[model samples]
Target: PDECPLAACVNILAPCRSVYRWQGKVENTTEIPLLIKTTRACYAALAARLLQLHPYEVPEIIAVPLVAGLPAYLTWVATEVLSSP
Candidate 1:
């Protein structure tokens, strides 16, 4: 267990190959993705912190609304994110 004030949890996924166009050129790179679990209330802060810490000029940061989740799990996440740091 760890103290994460801005997010309930974060999963550092395995690195994967990425291909995209940037600065008018196609690029291929290996990137590590992060799966973050946080409440809407904490999203802004989390994103800001990531931007401050991330080395990349343009990092991929997006939120996908959960369509459905186990009720108990969802409540736990919300509680964790809202609890005092």
Candidate 2:
């Protein structure tokens, strides 16, 4: 929550089970994904901060561009992020 203001908002999703291979072995774990809404301008700072906070040595951090969205909502995201430090 402390890092929320870095972006417009964050959507915490339900915990999901993940299965992946690491160090030549398969592993399973429960993880709660977060959907963060922010502009491309803010992505670098947000990702850098997440890297500092995440526990994993290589946490999954990827950006998917918004091809379409409600105009007002998109504006709000820009406004909120721009207004932040």
lDDT of 2 by residue, 1-85 (tens): 4545668889999999999999999999999999999898888888988999899999999999999999999999888885434
Overall lDDT per candidate, in order of appearance:
0.85, 0.87
Against the true structure, whose lDDT is highest? 2
lDDT of 1 at 71: 96
Each model's Cα RMSD: 2.4, 2.1
Where does candidate 2 have its weakest 10-residue lDDT segment? 1-10
Q: Report the C-alpha displacement of residue 27, candidate 2, in angstroms.
A: 0.6
lDDT string for model 1 (1-85, tens) is 2645778788999999999999999999999999999888888878888898899988999999999999999998888785433
Pairs of residues at least 3 apart in sequence or in different chains that clash in candidate 2 = none
TM-score of each: 0.86, 0.90
